[model samples]
Target: MRANKGLAGLIAGDTAISKVDVSTSSLWYRGYDINELCEKTSFLEVAFLLLCEKLPNLKEFQEFEAFERAHRDIPDSLYELFKTMPSYSHPMDLLNQSVSILGSFDEKNTLGSNSKEENLRKAMRLLAKMPTVVANSYRLSQGLTPVKPNKSLSYSENFLSMITGTETKDPLSVKTFDTSMILYAEHGYNASTFSARVTAATLSDLYSAVSTAIGSLKGPLHGGANEQVMYMLKEIESVERAKDYTLKKINRKEKIMGFGHRLYRTGDSRTAVMKKLGKALATKLNIHIWHDISDIMEATMIEEKNIYPNLDFPAASAYYLLGIPIELYTPIFAASRITGWAAHIIEQHNDNRLIRPSCDYIGPNARTVEPISKR
Candidate 1:
């Protein structure tokens, strides 16, 4: 018997965290529409909505932000550890290692009961620290000193500052970055979230679950697609060559980096928000070439293959124009996605069950193996 390949279209389980409606090509965090959140809510607000199951009022948000700010700094030992990782290590691996080491350092993260409150505390810790880890890891690998986190900046602005070594307070840039975080903050039971839930189902600690999720997100088919999108555009280089280059890839049956998604057949709902942000940034910065190349490629693909661009397509260029390095793209994805991962982990542990599944055996009817000498 043939098993379902990659479990496509299979209903693995239920979640109240987010809704991915392929029928309408829409995504919702809890019940809030993603587009609405991107437009009207800050990233922290979206994250709060995901974790708390309701939108926070101004007073609640201020308290939450202050609490998160208190935990933003990783231990100095972690900074020393970051200095020791080989310069060749992938930034994602560094992040995973950092989380693991952090678990060892924080008793609350490792030894606390799997209560909702405890999980929320740990989630806030991870959310506050991940940006610092990612930024400092990238900087340390570049032989540069790590920058300290600023308490006065908002979450999105602080992350931009840490990575760029300059305070990020521009309204448009902060808005675009915040919107990207909100767009990426969560999706219903995507690969990384599923990995997180599965690990949580085993009663593992939060850090292990998050580390596993990070490993899952590092795959090219998932979070890394945005990084690959930028690489593709850099190769094409100009609008004049965009269509021919894309067509050539199609002719050779090469997989395009950011065209189709598993869930959305027509278009990713998040794409429009990111595309708009990218266009605004491009125009604002007077850097139209990336946007021009993207437009031609998008038109070419839609006309030739009927494939629409996903969020990654525009996000790659948007982050590029924001002065972000390509290597940090997925880590930035992780920085936002930790909120979703934490929410799912809490949900799974609240309604705990083992997630074991079966597979069909097809090798020689399961005959006994021969001894090594006889073979």
Candidate 2:
């Protein structure tokens, strides 16, 4: 009876924030090709570029590093609140609560207040805080005490060392994690990013906007795809079972998780990169289960659905290799994506437009009847 909106084909608003070059099939932060940056740059380099609109010089990087280090500590009240949380509580839920606690101690509510610089600073703080909050939450969920981020290590390295107490000589984990962050930093109008934008559109605070993203990203259809992929692999178990299982599912019109992508008909661009990483990690792990499972899933999807693996497929295995819990997969996604979300919010604010949308109502006629007795 009416259009569903789906927000499809609707130019609800304009953005110069960052461009998704779907035609060229590339993403650019500000004006630089992200692929080029990823090849030659560190995650911090890319983050600086996204926030400041330029690749940082030595002094700028050093200063930014110092600033990030200085604010690494969450307020005592926030930590106390976290300490009191139940061990069985989801990390995302803990993070949602922590965000509220941190906001309560806000020296500068720069998110909706007057200082643009302070808002930017706050954005950087939240971005830096995400991994800490996640890793710390995990520690709390277990009996272990939460570790603070190392000031000596870079952001990428710090996250790793925090999760694993021992010093790691393996640089690959940090590199891969950072690369994953850059790859997943932002996508144009995805569910979670759109959630952030819509929240910002209402002129709400940044924490509120990003908390909305946490909820949006937790869904199986969105950021949960990676975990779902792993679950699919576990269900199928061996390579031998993959073919029969996938074929039966397809015959029954069942959906295969992490196989078909809504956007990419050819292949997922991030999957192209992650596949390379997955192969390397597979070699390192030298195990048969995941290696064979990933291989077979790719093959099965191609034969039955004609769909290629999206970003989620390899990411599931990649995180597994890094010793990250499957349950925290999407939370890690939020950690990477909060930077992009913050940037998008800032961009939305500068333009200053409310993102109200129109819907074609179609359930009933305009006239209304009274209660049952009166009717």
Candidate 3:
């Protein structure tokens, strides 16, 4: 039989855009490495690089920031839907639904065909409004009144404050969130983004495409990994007990929640930065339970089985410190990933392929015509 594919370890094609260097722990947008960008650039700067394929000069970035601010507000209907939703609904579901609702609003816009500058503007609205929707959705679920974003805050700070009514005012948290958004901005044909690309290939509305991606992101093996990581830590009571816990799971062949990744064979590049961010947050918050547990888990995993902490390990703690609801972890990922989704959608639209890949038949080989309703 020919090799079956989940496109596992296959080089589909060259993307001049960016590459995720899993083993080396590097991310680049166009040609600028993410570490450098995280130190020197804003998330919007990276977004411009991914979406428009170039760094925005000072004037262009200012114009883009102005445009994003103008579109950050969500419709009242979205707010009502969130308010009325039961606390039981995973926050990501609210985001998915809210994004779909946004599509209806976008449909009413003059840019129906994604053809004019207005269509691009509508896309910007989505990029801006998504964080608002996601943050508000969780706050609503928590029964905490959502705070309107203060334009004075940068995107990350505004998002944090909206989620938790307290103004963190910590520039480090803001910087970390921004960098995670940049790290997550795009990766070629990742699961959720591929889900986005596939939906967009049908010429679906951006919100529909993005919303579908949000749903996929909710899976534990996908964006839900971080939430699961926190849950797992919350399960194990202490660092001393972590070894036995992890060893038992590994021996049973149960997948460790945050220890691995398909794309990053050796390790996830983004994990190191998020881990640093998580440690800092833990120190400031004076709660090292999760971080301490993670340190033990990583040390044990590497010594026992050579497993490494992937992005989700630290992201779980970082988002928790940022006051994100556990269930909304992946939705937040969807919010950040909207950039990648939009980029891939635009790329697919320009190249325009139907993306029909072949599936091999493995069941009964052309079995003798089955008698109708065979017993």
Model 1 is weakest, by summed lDDT over 10 consecutive residues, at: 105-114
In angstroms, how far off is 157's CA in candidate 1?
1.0
TM per candidate: 0.96, 0.91, 0.91
lDDT of each: 0.90, 0.75, 0.77
Better of 1 and 3 by TM-score: 1
- Give per-residue CA lDDT, model 2, range 1-375, as digits (tens): 333446555555665545766566566777777777677887777777766767899999988878877777776666666677788887778777776666666777745662446557767888777778878877867768878877788887887777766555476777777788787777667888889888888888777888888888888888878888888887887878987888898889987777765556767667767667766776877855786777776887787778888788888888778877777777888887877787777777777778776666678778877899997
| Number of the predicted model whose lDDT against the real structure is largest | 1
lDDT of 1 at 30: 90
Candidate 1 segments exceeding 4 Å error: 1-3, 110-112, 365-375
Q: Give the per-residue lDDT of model 3 (tens digit) for 61-160.
A: 9988887877788888777778888889888788888877887787554333644244456567888898888888877776778777778877777777
Cα misplacement distance, residue 247 of candidate 1 (Å): 0.5
Highest TM-score: give the candidate number: 1
> What tens-digit string does per-residue lDDT give for candidate 1 at 1-375?
343788787888888999999999999899989998887889999889999999999999998899878788988987888788888888999999998988778776654367898888889889999999999998888788889999988998899999888898988888888898998889888899999999999988888899999999999899999999999999999888998999999999888998998889999999998999889998899999998999999998899999999988999999999998899999999999999999999999999998988886566655678999998
Give model 2's TM-score versus the native structure. Answer: 0.91
Q: How far is candidate 1 from the true structure (C-alpha RMSD, Å)?
A: 1.6
